[model samples]
Target: MTNRKPPLLILLGPTASGKTKLSVEIAKANRCEIISGDSMQVYRGMDVGTAKIKPEEMEGVPHHLLDIVDPDTPFSAADFQTIGKRLIDEIAARGKLPFIVGGTGLYIEALIYGYEFSEGGADPEFRKEQEAYFLEFGEQALHDRLREIDPASAERLHPRDSRRIIRALEVAHLTGVPLSEQLAKQTKESPYEVILIGLTLERNLLYKRIEERIDTMLANGLVEEVQILLDRGYSPSLVSMQGLGYKEIVPYLQGYSSYDEAVYLLKRNTRRFAKRQLSWFRHMKEIQWVDVTDSSNFSAHLSAINAIIAGKFA
Candidate 1:
């Protein structure tokens, strides 16, 4: 007979979409632990900008993967998949539910689909060549190159997305195959049955929440947080510093822009990021969308989630 166990429940959505609070409430009710799926939140000292859950906010529910790595260290989706799967197993072993929560679609997808990364070696020299090409010719130049070799991949990537552009080029150079084809060839079953719950709102309301969140972060010592990281010798070029709100303030700290200007730019960029996140989640066929515009009521949402979980586990 097949062993009967409960599936993982994933709470995912764009930034500033009320995920942390809702996830905490759900965990409290269901006797579950939350394993964060966010990429940035893994870095130590990245608190305010990442909107990390504070100790008081945890409300006695355990959260995993919030502050595990140094900001300068490399953390990939593959690494997240390995660590998250282990955490889920451990949580299950403790006789509790595992709830995954965050806005990072790639990380969530990696966990839910168990995507495998190729062990194909990357050439530092080749990577440098691509980086130089990106620096000199701009992201469009690299995106155009991807268009020629892998139209499918290029179509998926935004021309302004420098990191993914470089990654696509690196994958193509290392494997002698289009990055899209490499991804297409990889197939792995999910290690856990999962229920993906996607939180969303109307565009205007979402943007409003994002702007308000930025204000709250600023009022809550976001600049001080970045200052502390900088004081600790974390470079602006580090991955953690490159996160949404953190990166925009680097210029201000360096005297390139005023603090107010930096805040404005940060809010604008955050809104754009939220839009991209929504687009990504919209393409995910498995997600059960929850609209929070009218009510913003956690009780209502929790009731819906509890009913879904009960049905799945019953």
Candidate 2:
């Protein structure tokens, strides 16, 4: 490890858990710039569904990695790590702190823990074969195949997570090794001296917040946003379109489902996603969790975090 300390702060939590607001506050206080950890927020014109921070809400805290990629372009975790690390270094070089904030656990972990991806190249032919297999045999058949190869990974991934499942299978087919084994072999010490601050709230309140956010998105022209993307020739099958709220509402836009049904499903899926995020972060032993159930007194949480940062950097 290098003797020089790298300044990086990570504020992470589930969706609708108030991470964005807290992160902005922390960044402004620390003279830091924010790098978003969200996978969807990287895509341009995905504002409403991704719940991207409005320009006014930023309060003059500069943010990087938001709206950088086109929706039709493929983005991967490895790509994010490469770009994120560069930005982190650039920020630190300027004598400012780097605040990484988002609810995407995989993206956050990739940046903090430093996962090494295989040097495997994408095989269009193999992807087509896997897509055909799913179309012919269904999702369960593919998941069962994954179970036979990597039971542990299969256990964690839901069957309906077609994207990851397909990627795993494609990797196995091309490399002749299970994807789990590849991930297992790849590890590195994080280059930064980092602090992980996780924000959470009561389950009931979090769910309520998610519902209200979905309602706000609908009212704020989320459907119109999706329609514009579609008009731009973006496929519904694209990875960007498959994001949480975006995918759920596509059918409604296509007249296959009622708007009410679409909103209900989006809220339900978002709640489930938040629960999964909480579970994932809970297992990371290094995190200092803040329960913001009573937002009336955020000072306690803020003070605790400041104390930790001072202890680490002093």
Candidate 3:
């Protein structure tokens, strides 16, 4: 038997799992154009906090979908799917593999499986109440409310993503089925010959990398970056501002928390976020998981991944 869908390659994993360096190397060797699957990286001027790839870091391998919107604008999984699908086709047309590389599982899954978003109208009153609740109690408390009704959806969604949390809550309230259940019922059939590669590390080592990454971000002026965004008039209430690094720093800048307190919260929240990422990707049955815990053995890991890709796509 033979399958003939267009080839698509995805390199995804928890944050700080070495996806960035590996993806660029794989792309350069495989003649692939990389599209970012990270939700936060889509916003312009969020470079430091998102750990967005600098041009020099790309090493001439073409990348797409980074810095595409303002911090205040709302970008969602559906937007990623629409644009990602187009890029995949265009890249395939040029005889290059379209490699989606990032830790954002929902965005990648939505694009790969063609998730149809429900058009169920929202109740403004319900939505307003949810917003008010978030404002009063904060994102984690609001996220906990969703967890009670939709644990599956809650597991995949970041606590700071209050917008989606509210939507999931609304969907459950309106339709009586969890948003995760609706997505699970969606046709899982993909439009491409997809090869999903997942990277992982021992939990302790992964946490080390995450902490180091955050330290590097702070040293590289993450605070200044957030300050710039605030100066540009992006409100702290915007969904993008609720992102990991930005949100944690906001209280510090507003004189509510000390710099040390903000840093601690950022590191802890990032670790929790990474754990959620692993949980989400683990639920996707198609991914070929690889352990790249040893930074000293880069070639070994890359070779193994390339072999997997070649075996499937060659």
The stretch of ten residues in a row with the least summed lDDT in candidate 3 is 115-124
lDDT (10s digit) by residue, model 2, range 165-203: 888887788888887677656553677788888887899
In lDDT terms, how accurate is model 2?
0.85
Q: lDDT (0-100) at residue 222 of candidate 2? A: 95
Candidate with best lDDT? 3
Query: Candidate 3: misplaced stretches above 4 Å?
Result: 1-3, 136-141
Model 1 residue-pair collision total: 0
Give per-residue CA lDDT, model 1, range 268-301, as digits (tens). Answer: 8888788778877776788898877765477888
lDDT over C-alpha atoms for residue 212 of model 3:
98
Off by over 4 Å in 1: 3-6, 135-164, 184-188
Quantify all predictions' global Cα lDDT against the true fold. 0.83, 0.85, 0.92
Per-model TM-score versus the true fold: 0.91, 0.91, 0.95
Clashing residue pairs in candidate 2 are none
Supply the TM-score for candidate 2.
Answer: 0.91
